[model samples]
Target: METKHIIITGTSRGIGFELALQFANAGHKVLAISRKTPQALLGHSNISCLSIDLSIEEDLEKVTQFIEHTWKKVDVLIHNAGVLLLKPFDQISAKEFEDIYKVNVFAVANLTRCCIPYLQKGSHVVTVSSMGGIQGSMKFAGLAAYSSSKGAVITLSELLAEEYKEKGVAFNVLALGAVQTEMLQEAFPGYQAPISAKEMADYIFNFALTGNKYYNGKVLQVSSTTP
Candidate 1:
């Protein structure tokens, strides 16, 4: 595999951390961003880890400038940072909904915009959503805000694909199923997933590397039956 400069968010732990590990271990330069730094990722000479909360608007600009100066163009840009809030419909407030959208949608949009000028012809932009965002997926009943934000991300990816296809930049969204991670545990309390975070991360990393070859402007719903 060629050494590519990859940018991934939410790398404090779970899927994002594993994504960084896999790419960096493969000798790729991984620009891992997260609100908190993962201790293990620090030892990798190939990974440049940034501890910045994407929800903050100012931080987005800083990331854009940092990537501009450090890497001329991003080979793979993965918008993997997201927030999950399980709240009943009646109890969901504007602030709660906005907060989730800021991380899951707005931040993704803003960062992608910043990277547009630097996106190479074959660059791939992948957004990590949840199964909750898919129309036919089984809903767990309390992820209205979270799911809606993800749904918006799916649409955003499609729009970007249409807008950038002429430039050869591919955009896609992955509606991921339940994975055993801290976020999953918090959202579905006590639930066990059929797959681990590392497993999902491996699949995502490989898919991000080549999914655009056969697909773009598509939402690939990846799921495993849960008992």
Candidate 2:
């Protein structure tokens, strides 16, 4: 297998952490970004840990500049950092909404824009979205803000895919369903899920490596049924 250089956001925990380890184990060079470096990933030859707060535009600019200086191009750019605010619409403050969009939509867009110059043909960009992005759940009483932001990410991925298709760059969204992670536990305190972050990470990494052209611009939903 060819060794690819991949950049992944939210690597301090959950799916992002697993993805980083899996990619590095597969002989890929991974640049993992998060607010702070996790001790577990402190020193890995194939992994470069970057401290970046995606909510800050200046920080993202610095990251982009660093990537441009250090690497020729990124083979895969995975926007996996996100925030979840579960509160009633009325209870959702302006600052909360801003925070959600900052990390979920704006950061992803800014990073994608910055990476365009460095991204080569055949490169893939994947956004980690949620099942809420696809179908609304009335059962989950207060998830409007989070759901809306993810929905926007899904659309953004589709539009980006079309815009970059001619250049051989692919944009896709993974609408993950009930993955067992810290985020899941926080979202649904008592709920149990069949999917684990490791399982999801394995699928995502394989998909990134072997997915066909037809998979571009699609929202691939990975649920309990998914393997």
What are the TM-scores, per candidate, against the unseen true structure?
Answer: 0.96, 0.94
Instruction: List the lowest-lDDT window of 10 residues for candidate 1.
Output: 218-227
Candidate topping TM-score: 1
lDDT for model 1, please.
0.90
Top candidate on lDDT is 1
Total clashes in model 2, counting residue pairs 3 or more apart in sequence or in different chains: 0
Q: What is the lDDT of residue 72 in candidate 1?
A: 80
**For every candidate, C-alpha RMSD to the true structure in Å:** 1.3, 2.0
- Per-residue alpha-carbon lDDT of candidate 2 for residues 61-117, written as tens digits (9 for 90 to 100): 876777778777889999999989888999999999989999999999998998998
